[model samples]
Target: MTGTGALARMQAAFASAVTDGDEAAVTAHLAGDPALARRRLAIYREAIGANRRGALRSAFPVVARLVGEAFFDEAARRLAAVAPPACADLNRYGDGFPAFLSTYPHAEAMRWLADVARLEWAWHEALSAADATGIDFAALAAVPAEEQPALRFSLHPSVRLVRSAWPVLAIWEANQPGRDGTPDRDEGADDVLAWREDGRVRMALLAPPDAAFVEAIGRGTPLEVAAGSEGWDFAPMLVRLAAHGLLAGFAGPQSAG
Candidate 1:
């Protein structure tokens, strides 16, 4: 076991070795004293588990409020056991948690748990998205017609657009720190537009068309000139993006209306 195979075996051992009750196989392979190897393995397991748990906790603070502390911890622990972290970057952990919660036994009762998880993940992603020097409205308004064609547009890194069938925003707001409100899904579901500008996460409800507009930009659409997307209102889209600082400068595409 001294060649590449040995290295492969060593890697496999780490996952297997980290289990709380198993150590005999891995300890025999290690060069160190058996007792020392077992203890070290235990330490690694605890540290990794703790780090993963903390990341999950941070990603789902709102969910934690909806469910009490003890329940949240138990669910997090179970989720860790079910879906181990795929990347070492703890900041982006729980990216797949939304799908996981969709089937998680304890969370099955809450059909909206998955939606909340998705919203939380989006919030986390928005916080780390590339930053922009907010949309320069003055410059945009000043551009001349001929120069506009060549003008390119880009978005602030913080802009993230999310659309869900669930009344996600209302539910999230209902569980907010100072919210004295009620959950009224029947009122309407919402499209949530979020951006991390001014060093904080800011979110608002978007009309269908406005959401489509931002999504178009996100999918690499140049500042959309035309409006009336599907059945959504363009005014809401314009107003919301302008307000949240999602507008990055738009460059002129090859041609426009």
Candidate 2:
């Protein structure tokens, strides 16, 4: 193999050993006493496992705290083993964790934990999304009333919607800094709206109508069609969206529908 090819092969073998705990390729590739190589590889594997656990702990602090550190660490390690990092960026590493927790046998007792994980992930994503300018409502108002129905409004990239059958917003807020009271453990469904504001991530519980409106707008649905949806009421939702700087811009009739 050429030098680049040889390096790629070695890297692949190292990844296999570290991620899967398979030592055969590593044992053959390393130049050292067989026993020493195995021991050193074991050390590297342990370090990687620890790193994955730490990454998860940071990403899902509430989840870790709720489960207790020891159990969280073990769960993180097992999750990492199954869903090894696909990229070098750790920020994107825990996308599968929420789903994994839903089916995780040990987490069966804490059914709401997975929903909490989803809320945390949304917050994390919103924090990293790009900044956006506020909507041009003046221009929107200038459009002909008859044509306004075809206008398409854009959502800020930082906005995220997370729906759950648990009171995820209450659970998340209770875990925030300087919080004292326990969450209600309310079984009613909730839809959380998360976005970046003033360079910090903020989350709020959205009523069903508002959630439906925001979700439709985010998907580029036309104003008329979106407003006609089951739970939509244009005026109030528009005011809320504008106040929070959620609307990015709009495409008028000729530009959109």
**Candidate with maximal TM-score:** 2
lDDT of each: 0.74, 0.86
lDDT, candidate 2, 1-257, per-residue tens: 59999889889999888779887886788896988888898899899888888888888988987888888988888888788888888888899999999999999999999999999999888999988878876777788988988888898899999988888888887787777537866556989999999889988888887888888889999988788655445788777878989889998778744
Angstrom error at residue 188, model 1? 2.9
lDDT of 2 at 14: 92
The deviation in Å at residue 131 for candidate 2 is 1.2
User: Each prediction's TM-score against the native?
Assistant: 0.77, 0.92
167 in model 1: Cα distance from truth in Å?
Answer: 2.1
Q: What TM-score does structure 2 among the candidates reach? A: 0.92
**Error at 78, model 2, angstroms:** 2.1
The regions of model 1 sitting more than 4 angstroms off are 1-12, 19-24, 30-40, 135-153, 178-187, 222-226, 229-236, 255-257
